[model samples]
Target: MGGFLSFVKKETLHIVRDRRTMMIALLMPVVQILLFGFALSTEINNIDFAVTSPNRTEAVRRQVERIAANPYFTFKGYIAPNEIDNALRSGRADAVAVFADDYDRQTAATERGEPAEKAVQLIFDASNPNNAAAGAGYMQSILLAGRQTGAAAPETRLLYNPQMKSAYNFVPGIMGLIFILICAMLTSVSIVREEETGTMEVLLVSPVRPIRIIFAKMIPYFLLSCLNLVSILLLARFVLGMPMSGSLAGLVGISLLYLMLALALGLLISTLANNQVTAMLISGMLLMLPIIMLSGMVFPIENMPGILQGVSCIIPARWYIEAVRKLMIEGVPFADVLREVLILAAMTAVLIGVALRKFNDKLE
Candidate 1:
């Protein structure tokens, strides 16, 4: 225990002295958090729309004018009935609201339960989901306020998202996986680099035991990584306004477990690799790719192909992402995260054991 504490102290000192490691552990998370939180958003606003109201009657014109006045929509111009297809095909319009001659008659007949001769056809480019959702929402609001005041509300609602915000789904997972990558993968290479440089040899030959050396190397990075985690959480909540519906303590606890897993993975990589460059290549390709691809950070795991979903089961990042998202976004209790936490702990223990055995072999 004394040797471990002394080695931890030495490792912390070494990390603090190394400027590059400091930058990676501290700066990368802040930059990634800000970029993903602010720069990438699926929220739609000021969508372009075109109308081809050929009826040209006073009533039809007035309704078109009302829709144009809505802030949620921006009308480009009118097109001929035939040109509506050309405009939509050429990507000149997201939607074209066309009023047939019987539109006015249809309005009156719809109240009396009789189908009219012609209907208002809203032709839209259904390619972009965000644009389509925004267009549909704006059109529905316009029709509801202007025409459907007494109409019965549609039943059997299927919510697009209960929260309907991009961050509500994305930020939590991004934060978790990014933290793991920055802290674990980045730190792993730095420590392994020292071993390859003969500097680690000098320390091991001195009074330092293997356990102390590992602990010293880890403590500073562990603290710095924790700071990075805090920054991500703050950005998600205070800046992006993503709700932290669960206990902060629960999140921090789970985060610590994940960090340990990352640190252990780093230690394991450093132990096995011949040099710093090899450590980085191995960590980035073998660990980082699996984490980012399978972790549900950018894509839904449920939507993945059967083989990919099965592959996701082995990804530590996937478990970490799910655990942190549930804790922070959905407000899942610590008990709910317990199974994931246990899995992470088990993985960490296994990696640490392997790393220790490898380190001992190197020393011999």
Candidate 2:
């Protein structure tokens, strides 16, 4: 017991005195959150479009005004009838809406119970899927609503992000995922590094129990992760104006629990890896890839093929990402996230057990 306490003290001292550990555990998450929030976004806003109306009638003018007034669109000067391809190729236009010379004739035909004699040409840039989809949806909604009620729908409901902003969704999950990467995989490599440098041997030869050494190495990381959670939430609220829909305390509790799981995973990897370099390589390829790919951080799991969806079930980050989004975006109750919390708890238990068994074997 005395040996364990002494080892814990020594471990704490090592962590606190080391600048690299502090930077990895704390600074990395902050930088990643900011970078991803700014660079990676799904929200399509103020997309430029070209309009070419050969007839330039009053109906076409009204249609152009409608598209221009929408928050999702910006008028990018008129395009010649033949310049639609050029405008799209030069990246000057996301879409082009062309009104036929007899557009009034079509409206008149429909009103007069006759066959429509004209149609509008909508040329879209399909490369930017989100923008294209938004542009199409906006055009469809405007025309449908105007033809029916002459206004936008007042009953529209956005399920997750009411503002339809990408930052709100991506930042929360990215923040959680980045912390997992830094905390779990990096901590694993750090412990293995000590072994490579002979520091682990020096500690093992001392009076410390293996359990104490493991827990001590993990304590600083745990604290750092908690601090990271607080900072991220602050940034999301203040910088990006994202609201936390669930209880802050509950979210914090879950974050700490996930951090512990990450620490155990690190310890498990540390025990298995022959050296620090191998540990980092293995964790990055094996653990990090699955977390980033399967966690639905950037890709929707439901949209993935059946085999990949089945594989995603085993990823810890998927649960963590889901929990974070639910808390931050959906404002779900603690009870709602209970199943995910339980699954995480079970995974932590297994990792800790595996780590302890491996450490025992190494000692023997």
Candidate 3:
């Protein structure tokens, strides 16, 4: 136990010795949190809204007033019916509320038990889907809220995700990306550094088995990655307001499986690369691009071409992120994630086997 502790202590010290790298690693998540908090948001706080009314009924004026008074929209006043295209094209309005010429009559007739179609039309700029969806929903809610009960036959109800927060989609992706990169890069670089510094030979000659040494070396990074996983979950739940709708134990179990896969992949990279730089290049750039582009992190895999989709099947983050979204967002049962768990376990076992084989050969 003492000897194992010493080995872990040494590896931890080695990891933290580089102040610059340590700072970058620690601050990277903070930067991501800031960017996700501010820049990557799809919440529609302020959207420009315009109105078009041929007859300028009191009902239209009241509706426009309500929209303008609400904080979600910036009322851009009324536009001519002919200028709808111009307004939308010029970006002068994100959405235009069009009222029928007989809007007042429609409302009055409906109140009197006479049939009348929808008197108001909502035209939105679909260029920004977030704005378009949110804006249209906002306007619909406002209009519906103003009407009496039974005035509208149908109602809109958003279940599970009522607010439509975009962070829910991003949190799992970021977690999958961040944990794998940090764990893999740290493990690979530490091993490669020992090789580069000529210290590996001295360690290899000692009483410890090569696999034991490699496993011991990986211990610190695994714990660190676990802490990182916890911190990420906390950030996702509290700061980002993302829900832990599923089982916490389930999330942790799956994440630890992914971490093992990441560390094993790092070992595999360390076996391939002779130096720290090469290991970092292989782990960072080579892994990052595929994870970001093909892992269904930022884009849907089903939408990709057959070749890219096939390529994505091999990316570890693809399965991990998919499992996370299911567990964290969709709140599926543990049984639901059996496929991801099985695939990741197989990948981890294969990587560990291959890495250990190469490591033993190199030691011999």
Candidate 4:
């Protein structure tokens, strides 16, 4: 009994002495609560909107004013009918309200107990299909309310994300979470463990090049991460009943690219850490938390503060998640996700180059 008690006391003291572990234990809950509390929200607001009227009649003016007055929309004022497409393509507008010259005439006809077709058109930038669908729905509700008489509702046209399923948003986010957590945390801890046990010094003395050694260690984990990716996709499909609407080959290729980026990031973390505990803390607190909170995994980047949205730009998970959503949910071709693929590729190259440079410096 006394021996057992002494062992417990000694272990407790050791834990107390380990500042990295102690700090992680103390700070983790606080950090998670603050991040999740502040960042997680589904409520969409402040949607950018453009208005175009062929005749600019009182009815058109009233409809525009009503839409602009809504809390969800930020009206960018009237643009030329020709400029509406450019505005959406340039990301200057999320939705466009186009009123035909016959809008007032149609409304008058409806009021006079006659069948009339309303010429109000609502066109959405379906790039983020979820937001586009939701915004369009809200606008439709508003238009319906404004129709005191039996007037025809506005015609809605969706561009890209037509289904607007919540699953489409979450599946890609889950992929980002799995890849980053598995690749970065696991690799960082695995490499740092050897350093703590003094085995890294022995390996460094061997004929094997340090870069090669790093790659050899990472290859198995990379394969394991791939397996995990497949498992996740299976579960998402069969269990969650989510549809994979995109090309399977494209999804796999992009996922592999993201996996490499994550692995490279893990190697970067390992290079900075002196021990496994530090690596774990850095991966969990710095990498995992941001991936969840700032990477558009749990929160919409558009709803975030401008500064936080800017911060999300640097998170590789953000790009990958967006790419996967576009591909898998929207069934977009590889050409559509080209920018995301290129960004991940560039980031992977930079991280690998930097990690190798640092490893060589350490070897010297």
Give the whole-model CA lDDT for all candidates, comma-separated: 0.76, 0.79, 0.84, 0.77
Score candidate 3 by TM-score against the native: 0.84
Candidates 1 and 2 compared by lDDT, better number: 2
Q: List TM-scores for all candidates, in order.
A: 0.85, 0.89, 0.84, 0.59
Per residue, candidate 4 scores C-alpha lDDT tens digits across 1-364 of 4534443454345445767854653443334333333344354678999998878887788888888899889999889989989999998999998887899888778678789786788999998888889899899888766766443655566654453344546667767876787678877887888788998788788666666667766665576667667766675667545557777888899999988888888888998899888998999998889989999988889999999999999999999999888877677788888999899899889988998788777667
Q: Rank the candidates by TM-score, best first.
A: 2, 1, 3, 4
- lDDT ranking, high to low: 3, 2, 4, 1
Q: Against the true structure, candidate 4 has what lDDT?
A: 0.77
Better of 1 and 2 by TM-score: 2
Q: Supply every candidate's count of residue pairs whose N, Cα or C atoms clash at under 3 angstroms.
A: 7, 2, 0, 0
* 159-208: candidate 3 lDDT, tens digit per residue: 65677776777778888888778888888998999999989888878876
lDDT of 2 at 102: 83
Clashing pairs in 2: 245-331, 246-331
**Best of the candidates, TM-score:** 2
Put down candidate 2 lDDT per residue, 1-364, tens digits, no spaces: 7776676676667777887866776777677777767776666777888998888888778888888888888989777988999999999998898888788888777666677755577889999787788778888777655545333346688886877777776775676576667677767877888888988888888776767777877776677777888888888888777888798888888888888888888887888898978888878887878877777987899999999999998888888788888988889988899988999899889988888899789767
Error of 4 at 163 (Å): 6.5
Candidate 1, residues 124-232: lDDT per residue as tens digits? 7888876886778768667656765374755344343354567666766666666666666666776777776778778778776766777677777788778887888
Q: Report the candidate with higher lDDT, 3 versus 4.
A: 3
Better of 2 and 3 by lDDT: 3
